[model samples]
Target chain A: MSGNPVERLGRGTTDLVVDLGGLARFAGRVVVAGSGRPWRLRRLLDEVFGIGVLSISIIGLSGLVVGLVLGLQGYNTLVRFGAENSLGAVVGLTLIRELGPVLTALLVAGRAGSAIAAEIGSMVVTEQLDGLRMMSVDPEDFVVAPKAMAMVISMPLLSALFITLGLFGGMVVAVGIVGGDAGIYLTSLESSVEFREDVLGSLVKALVFGVLVALIATWRGYTAEPNAAGVSAATTSTVVASSVSVLIFDFFITALWRV
Target chain B: MNVSPLRDLLVGCFVLAGLLSLAYLSVTLGGLSYRGPGGLQIHATFDEVGGLKPRAPVVIGGVKVGQIKSIQLDGDLRPRAVLDVDPAVGIPVDSSASILTSGVLGDQYIGIELGAEEDVLKGGDEIQYTQSAVILERLIGKVVQNLGADSE
Candidate 1:
């Protein structure tokens, strides 16, 4: 019976596909339940503080490092062509479009994604999720909505913070450290770029990534089996799924934008 | 029929609102760079785009005016990059396209250096000249190797 290859293959493929379908439905249900809750205001507060308010320091520090690195690297490249003035736009545009979104998603995946998986997985193992169902209360409203809403809301502000911090970080390295003229750099960058386009793409990516991360983590945790073993799996799955999902969506969005 | 569609409808609205937040953020963040009131698209081509990704900005004079819309290999096996520029900033046809790196280890994007030519490049115009991105690490290695040879 254990060596039944045909049965194993059939079961594995069926479960994989079915799991994905079930996950999609579960995600939809989460959104619905979250919205229908009377404590929507409270949920919003938790999301903002947990996802956005608390993440400021890390996001800021990362932005500073990236910006400084960009400045240092950019100076070397531009000095060769004698077009060193292009540094600000390079830093600004890159942060707005690619690094800002990618980094933020990664950070959130680690912090929030793992947390979601752990929270839900623990709940599942303890029978809390089932208890809610038994009591006719929607767990999605009480759980999923807060996390998802927080991500969607806080991502844009975080992106902007990343951009602003990066700009300053680059400023320190370029102007203060490298002796580049700050006024000239800003003027050139302002004349050449707009904040809206750069920020818009990041906002979009973050929002989507947030939702995806929430979905994956919550699903893995909520549907986990085998108790403690399931928690470990859920945690791993949440991080892996969030990271992979971000990269996949990044590719798709990039492709679509190009079109 | 006996149950309430009203409950389902309420749930739907909540979900919709959450979705809208995502969509709204995407649109706003994407438009943060050079954008006109009404969005517009422009096109450009390059021999080598390097590692340029989509949503990569179309910058002129170190200012982003658009984004790279698509990239494909031409009949000559050259990379042809399509750009989406804001309608407001008019690019002249004789403008030069160069693949420039943001820094030592950063993403590459095509830069349009506007020419002082009397006629401005309109929509569907091609940038006459192109320069591919110059990687700093490669350049530095070459410089160091040459110096080592001199010392030897």
Candidate 2:
């Protein structure tokens, strides 16, 4: 039984190595397909409308709710120490530095990443990609590039909107509901958050998460087996894989930010 | 397939809102500004700046007229702070600058009280009188020592 477990572990490691190789090759093809002439602006707009515009309400509402919760909890904790005045700085820094980008990416991964994978998976199952190839058209250029590019364009904007709403929500809870001094809250927030360091870092994190999610989703769909079950599996894996990688990369980015 | 104009317009609005929120975050909360070097520069030396830092506000009579541009150590190893004030706000040459905290544990800032001299302070001038930051620990220690001496 012990040897059996070791054998399974060895097989799993080999499979992971092989999958990583395939993913790298697929990513190279996508970059080549996306960067060339005929910028494909129309399809990109359609994808952006699908991915970004539709995701705004969820992103905004989640941001506000999270901010409110942070304010409430932060105030309760800080009041004990008589540091309730620093609530704004705490909420603002936490949102801009970490939660805003990470939450937005996770939301996008669940909402849009699954859809991209399923749509591409269905297209593959229906042999539409084969049809496009038969017509001397590249499916990667026509289908994958626009979706990936739209994700890259939308992520930072959505993250910014999320953070803005979060700050407003936090202010509502901290000042309006709790009766903290508005001037102190605002000044504390402004003083603590630096544009060059925290704001720019948040946007960069969002952008990197965008690239990671887009590549993983597209690659999964393109390589999925041509069947209904395969399409569902691809969608599920897209959500799971992208979410994991977004969090992992967030850790790495934050650790290396000052370096 | 051609997209509808209304849809494109919605997308445009979304993009605009995103950019607007980004601008708000960067400018208001992040304290970004495009002001050039149009302010009057003056210097003050202090024994201890305490929590005073660069970009701390410089106010007179509770009205802000400037900010600390930088903080450096002078040849005497004292903290020399450079203040950037609005050129429009004239200051007297004999004015005094003091480092004061906002509350018991809030951030520290520089407050200047105007002197009675007719001559307005000019650029690169130095404030004649200055007070250093009050350390809380030292104050408490002094109070304890005074009580001890009185009991003895």
- Clashing residue pair totals per candidate (backbone < 3 A): 26, 0
What lDDT does each candidate get?
Answer: 0.73, 0.91
Query: Cα miss at A12, model 1 (Å)?
Result: 4.1
Query: Across residues A171-203, which tens digit of lDDT does each residue of candidate 1 receive?
Result: 898899889999766744553443345445566
List the candidate 2 regions with Cα displacement exceeding 4 Å.
Answer: A1-11, B34-44, B69-76, B82-96, B114-129
Off by over 4 Å in 1: A1-12, A37-39, A194-197, B1-152
Q: Kindly list the per-residue Cα lDDT of model 2 for residues A112-169, writing each as its tens digit.
A: 9999999999999999999999999899999999999999999999999999999888
Please give, for residues B1-152, the per-residue lDDT of candidate 1 as tens digits: 13344544544444454345334333443344333445455555665666787667678778777777678887888878777777778766678888877765556777888778788766666677888767667789999999999998
Provide the global lDDT of candidate 2 against the true structure. Answer: 0.91
Q: Residue A242 CA error for candidate 1 (Å)?
A: 0.6
